[model samples]
Target: MTTDTDTALEVTPDAAAAEFDRQVRTLLALGYPALSGRSPEQFAALVAPLRAEAVARAGSAAYPAGPAGPETAPAVTGRVPFVLVVGRALAPVERTMPLTTLHGGRLPGFVDRSFEPGSLERFLATEEARPPGRDGVHLLCEVERGEEFCGVVPGDAMATVAERGRTPLTLEEGIALLTLFPEILVKNKCFSLGGSRCGDRRVPALWISKRAPKLGWCWEGNPHTWLGMASAGARHA
Candidate 1:
């Protein structure tokens, strides 16, 4: 879903770096400190590892598929469900999904594109009804590769390459790093909707996060791509 427009900023960095090196260097440049309100040195130290991790993973992880599709799990009833929408047909793939986030925002990498328009309205309406803090949000997700990313900035252990004099990364340090880079995520996977669309059609997973969606930021399907969604997940009433 889109960030609350008022919440959306003109200067907010790209959700993820499109061109990693240029983005990193621009943020690290001396004049760039104002972007994060941090000194250049401080900003550079925080984001370098994150850029490396994302780049490395994007380059290295391309394994052959073992299973033809995601396991056929069942829908969970009673507990809040994360509806895994894949095709134009709105159906549940799995339920009782467990997802976490750092900001009020959904962990990005769900998919780069936005969700359907009504998502935020539903989220706000649900939040207005809630006591406060817990999100019973509906999301129209255009999911991404789940095995690749996480919502939280990864721990210091992820800092593989380091400056000679600086201490290596740590958990506490990683958490603190968010003040500078809210987008950095721990290397982990979330539920993925990738390969759900086998044919040229594009479908979305309207998962209920904290609870799921029909976010307005959904990706428009390409006419050239055929849609093929797997029939996975259990159906419950």
Candidate 2:
């Protein structure tokens, strides 16, 4: 039988770096939310640090530092596979465009529900399915595309609910959280679960936002964003 090792081949550092840059550019062309507001130079700068960190973690053989300098390197650790969860908010009409444009004229009906107590478990049972990845640092992304700005929590991170007061999450906080953990954040507005499946697992769940768009946000034509959740078994591969 063909194993992962049989298919696995070595990649040079330069080739890997070039491929990474290419992927980033491709994502930008696809209207990634993180790269939307920033200029090309600014976007490059933002991703530079991340690229350095990834290289350092992967080691010199897989991703050498090159002429960039040692400061760019991130601490080395074990590697794993990961999936990014992209979410976005859309109006009844706005949502139709992506559905028609991206999914061949059919509308996808993803339900909206709060992440209350037992919500994760229920979602896992009903909505989520296993995703493809390595054994360590597995990632599962759940996006909430909606009209309003809601909050998101990392799958690995925990949240607490208060009885007398409101939840401990805000829209900005949620986006920031995803930004901080870009490995699991797809940073896109449109996604199709049925078509975008990894391995045998469909996905954990997607949280479609129901809030209104925030003012001063750069992306046009769409007023929503996505938040993805991931597991420890998932990582960026």
Candidate 3:
């Protein structure tokens, strides 16, 4: 009595193991271990327990895609919780890395003028901004760019997210998403990290600038035609 739907949902042990291995290699290639000050072995050990869970979470269905059109469509929408984002490990200047595919010579990621040293830490420290797990590695499931909310004010969109029982992504989560999947931040489809706030009007966001990704902020009450708030369905230890 095994239906096709049930079969599709079942992940074989081999498939799960393969998924975990791919994630480990991908993170290593992205220099996650160095960013977190952990050896490759240590990093892999941390993520080992969540192998099957990560793969299942990554396969979960996502919300409707935005109107970025096929040209700018993301290869993958949801992040599989493999990124290791040490919030305080490096300054914003050193933390952000430009995508290798960007035109012109290699460029580094930059924080907006509105931010200063330790600014991100303070914002992330707020109880309102605290992530679901500890300050180290964690899992975020069904994370979306919230592109459907584009042109909608962040404050209003957050209210809507709450009504739907979804969680807005934190600053660390946003950083992780960009660090792992730079293609998701294409033109006219940037996202706001509304989950991280300092009890003010500002909402952190990631966007493309001069063919590079930039971590910046915008007014909570404002709306942008291109930037939508990001969110997650759940988080795990």
Residue 25 in model 2: lDDT: 59
**What is the lDDT ranking, best to worst?**
3, 2, 1
Q: Where does model 3 exceed 4 Å of error?
A: 1-20, 56-59, 62-74, 77-106, 125-129
- TM-score rank order: 3, 2, 1
Itemize residue pairs with steric clashes in candidate 3: none
lDDT of 2 by residue, 68-146 (tens): 2323221111112111222222112123112211112123322333323333222211112232333211123212222
Write candidate 1's Cα lDDT for 124-231 as tens digits: 111111211222111111111222212312221112111212121111111112212222222221121221222222323222233122111223232111211111
How many clashes does each candidate structure show, in the order listed?
45, 29, 0
The candidate scoring highest on lDDT is 3
Best by TM-score: 3
Worst 10 residues of 2 by lDDT: 74-83
Point out where model 1 deviates above 4 Å: 1-19, 28-32, 61-237
* Model 2 misplaced stretches (Cα beyond 4 Å): 1-6, 33-36, 59-203, 206-237
Better of 1 and 2 by lDDT: 2
12-115: candidate 3 lDDT, tens digit per residue? 44444554565467668867677677888987786676665655654343222334321222244432323334344431324544422332335656677788
- Supply candidate 1's per-residue lDDT for 86: 15
